[model samples]
Target chain A: MAEAEGEMSSLLEEAAARRAAPGRALVRDAGLIVGAALDMAARFRRDGRLLAFGAGASAADAGHLAVEFTHPVIVGKRALPAISLANDASAVSGIAVSRGYGAVFSTQLRMLGRPEDIAVGFAVEDRCGDVLGAFAAARQLGMLTIALVDGALMDRTLVDGTLVDHVLDARSGDPRIAGEAHMTTYHLLWELVHVFLDDPAPLDGPGTAASGCAADATCVTCADTAVPVHVTELRPGGLALVDTGGGTEEVSVALIEARVGDTVLVHAGEAIAVLGGDAP
Target chain B: MTGALYPFAAAGGDTTREELVMSTAAKAAESVELRLRVLERLGPSLAACARAMATAFRAGGTLLAFGNGGSSTDAQSVAQLFLTPGRGGRRLPAISLTGDSALLTALANDVHFDVVFARQLTALGRRGDIALALSTSGGSANVLRGLEAARRAGLVTVGFAGSGGGRMAAERLADHLFVVPSSSVHRIQEAQATLCHVLWELVHQALAGAEAGGVQAGGEEASDGGLGAGGVGADGVGAGGA
Candidate 1:
């Protein structure tokens, strides 16, 4: 009895340690997930849906992630279309038993995915054969491939273009930690994608160069109605007084060194970047 | 170069690569430390949960588990663990209310989602049955409703929730509540899994007689020794998977 008690304590601590190990992995690798989310959001704008797949315990993640996107438990958030390839366990097993386990998810993707859709697959072991098949199938369909993997093949993912474009690796040997890391990665993707959707013409807009600060945000030409501006006064730090076709306004000049009478690009009371010379 | 929330190197072009490497290393060390602390704190409560669950199971009660989202998976896992009991333990009768897609969809579509689990419990639950629910937030309306239904039906209600126990604690819904006092959802889920394993083992120990004997139930795919691995689990969509 005493021995059982001691072992239980030890087991709890061990499980906690295993579970806790993913936070570091999330912090280090979550940026790559964010970058992928940005791309996926662009795909979303094109009316693309998300298709997710995984095997074993990870199968549950596929369902959880799908419901999160489709139903959106949070109030006021719009639902995004998502489907879990593993939702129908009968079909999955039927395929596995009849055709092969590898064909289960791939067959689903071939039937459901489109060229503009996004395919996200996850795995816990060094390789989830079914997930690998799904990614390959999705890539062939011209879908964007995102993999949340924490297995031994993680190092090879960066080198393998055919396997995945955006790979967020938990870098853990434990499945529990990998599962936790995958959740964090997907949550970050959901959040960062929302950040992109919150804008009509975000950083990728025509007039915006995606400069470091908002002071350098170029909405002048992008906004479609800003008038041409001529620099009337030039101060240090790229600050400029410009005369819009309408009136004089002050704008920041971080992108360009504006001189008096120089044609400066200004947007909503800010100078985006300076034109090389005065407007014709 | 220092960081605000984390100890990170100053962002610079030349040192960025080296700094990122250092930052990951430092962050890993810190995370392991925090995980260990969280684990240490959960030991006692996990023990309590095991003792309680063992008593309930030994008394011939069934475990009816439920949850939402990722937590629903946890509830299913809990049921699977009890139903199989792996190697050393006698298989106990447990059902995950979330496992039935037909029932889940019907309840969700026909009436309302809040009553999905509660309605099922009303029909299926009996006195001396055990109800186990998993919710990271502890505030999931459905889980709360299910727990209330389980308790009213004479079932012993237990909950696995994240830090602060959310509304589960606020309303005292669970008879034996296991709270993973972590704000991070990942950590909380992981801790919850660990707690379940501990509690499951204890329940088995309580039930495993000399005739039952010890069986290896570690990591290896230890299928049935004498019981046979028939219908290993309810794989959500159907009866079993290949």
Candidate 2:
């Protein structure tokens, strides 16, 4: 009661701070993330689907990311296959009751996922032990495993591990921040994967992504990015000379503000929006 | 390829000096505006929503929440935040309708998909309870049906919506509605988070005041306690509660 006077401001600040942790992390790992997404796009071209799962707060993340893929909010964007394993309440309880809480995610994957499909798991601390189990199951099936880990315990196992192909770390311990960061990371991944898929050169003309890794569907590659860069300057006619990881790329920022140094959301050939803001 | 990949045009890393400064500065601007807008225009509605929540909790009512996609996650977040509040706040009963996969899939499969939430409501809602619906577009069919169902079951309804509140505002749904006027979904969600947090705080604060004897109470039950007499059955899960 006595603390009510400043409670509003304090709470608002905490929310922003929580959002900031993941926001910054996603930006720093932009290149690595975009590369991982490019690999994911290639997988999708081979008719691979995405299966997302988590527990507690991260379960919501699984659902949110799944919906974004299954039903693209952006117009004309193709709907990719994605499923949230946590969407079915009865299946969850039955599995948790029969097997254990740690069995829900992996059990669903064992039933539904194929070797070509991708598994996205989110774990904050040790709260959701099944994320690891899901990864283990996905690995056994030779599916690509992408994990978003918040705490050191989960990170220690998932990062640089063979079981998970992609491990994105949020860098902060706040559970809320981890959840928020996971949202942005997935959103960014969704956008970039679309960008690569829309390009269609690799899938349409030559042997599809099903060729090299078709047997195991696990050979992934990450080139030094050609478009992942910061706009150095906005020239006339919606063009930007951006500093890429290795060199520079002249890109169109017609959709978003042609601002200098913004992390342009380059989808297909157009800069859809500046990262962290909605499409303009 | 969709045109040639944008050729790299700048030399050296943009990271050394300019990118970090400008990106951080520009990106944070919209969020700051979002915070300011919520802080300035959202206080009154948040107060009302909190008061409603406090009244419902006092009457031993449960808060039932529903939404779709990101809003669904937010709905669950709201429930989690309320049910297991950090600090020294009292634990309140709240349910995210989307959390139960079996019940949700069962309803969606058995009945019409749009009626999933509404069906849950019909089974569980009581007169003294509250239904909080979150939809960024504010026009999600399932959410609308759920609101109607809650109203029919004598529950108070509040909604978190975006961009002119969509049909929720147009159709005059929600006894209490807080609309994030922004068109950007990210900003809208951020603003909604602010409002939800503020509402949680305001309700906790009010409860603390009443519990501390700072506010005099009317000894008798607040009349119009809204059908609390014929509430949920002995199990409190209603007859058909799945």
Candidate 3:
């Protein structure tokens, strides 16, 4: 019994360790994730809805992502329009039967996707043909495309600004670990998108224009913008001292009711909303 | 070129990009911490549950999984994981009650949404089978109903819940309950996924132990070490030394 218990403990530890590396890898792509949220917010500002799809377990992820956006779990957060292409089994089966299985997501994308919408695809390991196809279709429709894929499967072509605007890799070969990392990735995406949307900053800033993806200059959109600041002290005159990653900055909090010890989304010296707080 | 690509660098004084990086890092750290905590807390219970599950599977029992919303999708993933696991893993008999959209909608529209899973359990569940339900809140009406039905039918009930197990913990609705001690729904679901995966691995391990010990059907005299002494045979067919 002692030996058995030891083995079980070791197994549990191994499982926990295996899931950690992929999650850590996501921290390296914070800039990319934040950028994606900015562009997703831009698309939503244009009355665009999010269309998410994937295969097998990833299909479930697609549903989870869609629900997170369409139904805000946190009170006071606005519900954004979103839909999961994998939710309707009847439609998926019909598309697979009529137009090969690889056409499932692509077919749905072509039918429902719009120029202003956002398309997020989930692909575990190398089983990403349908997701790749959907990205291709999304590109043709001028949609903002993002992909969450396994690190082993990400290659030059997928990240070369051709297929996906944002390619976040969950750096793990194990599909389960990759799925967990993907969950965290999308949660960040959901949270940061709200942060950007709440901010009144112009999406096409000087940095955006320099990236060669200005709204009027070109149709291309880049994902690398904005960050949240930690509020250290709330001043009396609608101002707060915020930790801006490097140093403290006194920013106007007139737009938001921010408290000390809260993370606030800042844009051009103004605090928009308190990050990860209850709606008050 | 560097400033252009990195908006934070181009924004002059705003160095909050580092904070953005830190935020992601913080969430990742939180996730790892929660997972480790769950493993440390539930390791023994997980092992015992896996043993029971292996015994039920050996006796030709299928796994019936159900949940709501994201948990509903997770239920489908659980079924899929068992039915088609990773390389070198054996295919197990499992079904997600949330797979059939038409049936689920019909049940919800015709009857109350609370009875969708319970009605399915009545039709598909049997004694000695396993019922796995996932709920972030642990107070979902339909999930409680499903557990009640599973208990009535003699199926081994397992529940994955969060936020102090909600009412499921209070009422003891599950034979083996794993509650992720968090109020964040996203974190709870992530930890639940890890728990499910670990349980799957342990079940495989238990099954392997059974195989190595030559514990086959119709051999009441055979003793496959202490692994077969879990006393999970409510049906009386697969009990050890029956």
Q: Which one is best on DockQ?
A: 3
Model 2: how far residue A126 lies from native, Å: 2.6
Interface RMSD of 2: 11.9
Question: Which residue runs of candidate 1 sit more than 4 Å off their true CA positions?
Answer: A19-21, A126-129, A152-162, A199-280, B1-38, B54-62, B77-94, B108-112, B126-129, B152-154, B162-167, B180-221, B224-242
Instruction: Put down candidate 3 lDDT per residue, B112-146, tens digits, no spaces.
Output: 99999999998999999999999999999999999
| Candidate that scores best on TM-score | 3
Q: B62-147 in candidate 2: lDDT tens per residue?
A: 88989887788878878876775533446678889987767878878888779989999999999989999988888899999999
Please give the ranking of all candidate structures by DockQ, highest first, separated by commas. Answer: 3, 1, 2
Evaluate model 3: give its TM-score. 0.77
> Which scores higher on TM-score, 1 or 2?
2
What DockQ does every candidate get? 0.13, 0.10, 0.18
Model 3: colliding residue pairs = A35-A223, A35-A224
Error of 1 at B225 (Å): 12
Evaluated at residue A20, the lDDT of candidate 2 is 51
Summarize candidate 2's per-residue lDDT along A187-225 as a digit string, tens digits: 667765765676533322222222122324322222212
Q: What is the C-alpha lDDT of each candidate?
A: 0.65, 0.66, 0.76
Candidate 1 chain B worst ten-residue window by lDDT:
B229-238
Q: Which candidate leads in lDDT?
A: 3
TM-score of each: 0.66, 0.67, 0.77
Runs in model 2 lying further than 4 Å from the true structure: A1-6, A151-155, A159-163, A200-280, B1-44, B84-90, B99-123, B148-154, B185-242
